[model samples]
Target: MGGLAWLTPRKRSATARSVLAGEAAAEAARKTEHEHESEFPTPGDTRAAAFFDLDNTVMQGAALFHFGRGLYKRRFFRTRDLTRFAWQQACFRIAGSENPEHMEDVRSSALSIVKGHRVAELMRIGEEIYDEYMADRIWPGTRALAQAHLDAGQKVWLVTAAPVETATIIARRLGLTGALGTVAESVDGVYTGRLVGEPLHGPAKAEAVRALAAAEDLDLDRCAAYSDSANDIPMLSLVGYPYAINPDNRLRVHARENGWRLRDYRTGRKAARVGIPAAAGVGAVAGGTVALVALQRRRR
Candidate 1:
């Protein structure tokens, strides 16, 4: 009892005050959480849009590769076609598709086979291809983000370099607003196998969004865009909110410099399994050494 001098009235008062302050903070936190429960964009009903870049953003891998598998199974081409495409796919996955040469090469090769086929046939095959391959590959996080935008009453569109048929199938399956993709000309409902314009890539993607915005009366300042590749910087820049999901190297730097938000959905195990050697964007950033390594592993 003689050593109890420290337990004065002041000390007891301070302890009670600390307990009350903690309770007050907890109550404030609960109120904030309740207020944000419906915090997604739709409550204001803005005339905004959500643009998503397909390939590696929504799906884990190349959309064209899965489309090629669908085409192959339907005998739209031969075994040699698959071999050639596989080689191209390996180079593409390793080197990345932002390179103009790579994009042109891929476009030329794909268009050559799609020529002279019936539009209906390709559309049917696209449905099957998406169900069998693409459906499972959809990233849950990206999907949720898109759905959030849709719930907010903003338009959600998938932008890709894939064929219109395949892109449409994916959009319809996912219940998105629409999709913009490379257009292959068809004559009398049969594939003429020629492109109406360039592949919707790089700057072209931005242009497409602009066209859509003009047509749909959307305010770009309220819009949002998401992508994985540095190639989509043009498109991302067109929006108010840009998310670099699973961003590549060049994109990572750009996002950081511009103070853009980023989310990484690619787990370490998948990165290791893919033999990426470094971050997904390393090949695009450091040197072709990483690209060479990735290509070699894919070959195996």
Candidate 2:
């Protein structure tokens, strides 16, 4: 134990440094981009907002995957890219955790696919895709929760690792205040195939909320956050009210231990299944790949 004593502190220091860096990056993003605030102003509470996770929390599947499916339908990415997305989806579904390396792979692939596309073009398509594929997938319970916050006059925001464009579209459609998502670098309204910072996942998510709270003059103690995976524990811990909605096993345990509220919208059989098959097989060709790969191996 003594031999490893020096390494423990060094690791902790490194982690602390990484988290601080993430916060700084998110702060910069907030300043550069204008979040889409609600048009209908609320007068009840101006100092508090609710931050919600996108995938498996506000929707049934990964928002990014759904966006990828739309891109695939529009021939934005080739079959090769679809295969990688499927593998990543399978991995994410099975693990039920935000593995940094896995998310990095997805980020890199998404950037490459949108390298030369115009931001406006993608946003237009995203709207269409959301209507066709994502609109009905939203959980009625979760929708009601968000509506309740809106009815209370508190702003509601979506904080997700999905692309900012996609998240913003969803927020607007749902009549939320705004969304904070992974920003992709663009030049002249065209994507440059790069990110402004890290994906808004895990610790970075907490950093984003902190930065936004400071900017908006929001009271952190009055804020609330909701998510499904334990990966968002950092973000969940930032707010006064943290809810585990459709929580994974680890999050379920953590929420119970912390005396947090837990809500599960899925049945026992559905909960046992990762539900990656649909996301993995987003396209006809990818569907066949999922069939052969047997990603449902996790259900066993």
Candidate 3:
């Protein structure tokens, strides 16, 4: 009955109803934040935790894009969906942040891809995908930083807009505390293709950190955050120690202005020779992906 409440509501578009439903799911996560504690004991500094962004900060490229590729290989989605993911990945790799328009398309397509899929099935595949696509892409410098936090007896979490299941798998693989990511709505262990709240991006990322902090009895002044995009400034600002890792242009400038510490692993001759052209190539492919997505939808 609760899930069907939207059916009895006053005038609301399908998009609006989806948003409202997601918000309700997010509220539930907030209320239960405390219960989602790290299974590993924090014996050293229990009040502090380090939060790392998934893309470009911890991993080399878009985590979702990698996941999508893995899913595509398994025939979980059609070729058009994969193309859309490639466009998003390219934009992210080049600009170092999400394009709002692409993100909306991605959100819709991502939901469509998972509709009617079992949660357990996705989780099982996600584990394999991580080993195949993500394991080698982790930035060693970022891994060490997270390790330092763990050594200090503090929790370390990955907070990203990627699906929570995927994020959790990465955290577990890395031997970190846990992750906070966008939730996909599920019923009877099957995905309903709707999100739980918004994707955990931008201001929403900060909000999630705050909720987790409150729930885990963490001190914001003792916590830290790392990211590669200016879009994450809100989350970065919330921590006592903020770092810009492999930052894009806007983030680099903003970090300098704010006196946030910056680290760039993609330096030296190799990056100079190959990086710019690679980024440009990625940005150029978005148009084709968008067209393909539209065509696929029409065919359906």
Cα RMSD to native, each candidate? Answer: 22.3, 10.8, 12.5
lDDT of 3 at 85: 93
Expressed as tens digits, the lDDT of each residue in 68-99 for candidate 2 is 88889889879988888878778776766556
lDDT of 3: 0.75
Tell me model 2's lDDT, rounded to 2 decimals: 0.75
| Residue 26 lDDT, candidate 1, scale 0-100 | 25
For all predicted structures, in order, the TM-scores are: 0.74, 0.80, 0.78
Candidate 3: clashing pairs of residues:
22-197
Question: What residue runs in model 3 are displaced by over 4 Å at the alpha carbon?
Answer: 1-39, 267-300
When 1 and 2 are scored with TM-score, the better candidate is 2
lDDT string, candidate 3, 1-300, tens digits: 355466635433443443443344244444333355545555676788889998888899888889889989999889878988998888877766667677777777878888999989999999999999999998776787777677667788888888888988898788887787888889999999988756777777887788778767899887889998888998899998788777777777788889987665554542344332223212213422432343234335
Clashing pairs in 2: none
Instruction: List clash counts for every candidate, in order.
Output: 3, 0, 1
Colliding pairs, model 1 = 42-152, 115-193, 249-281
Worst 10 residues of 2 by lDDT: 290-299
Query: Which predicted model would earn the best TM-score?
Result: 2
Candidate 1 lDDT tens digits, 1-300: 344356787765544433333233223223332454354223434467788888888887778878887788888788987887677677756754355676667668778888888889888878888989799998776787777666556667788877766876787788776677777777899988676555777766776777667655678877889898898998899988788877777887799899987765567654554333335432222222332343234336
Query: Residue 97 lDDT in model 1?
Result: 38
lDDT of each: 0.69, 0.75, 0.75
What is the clash count of model 1?
3
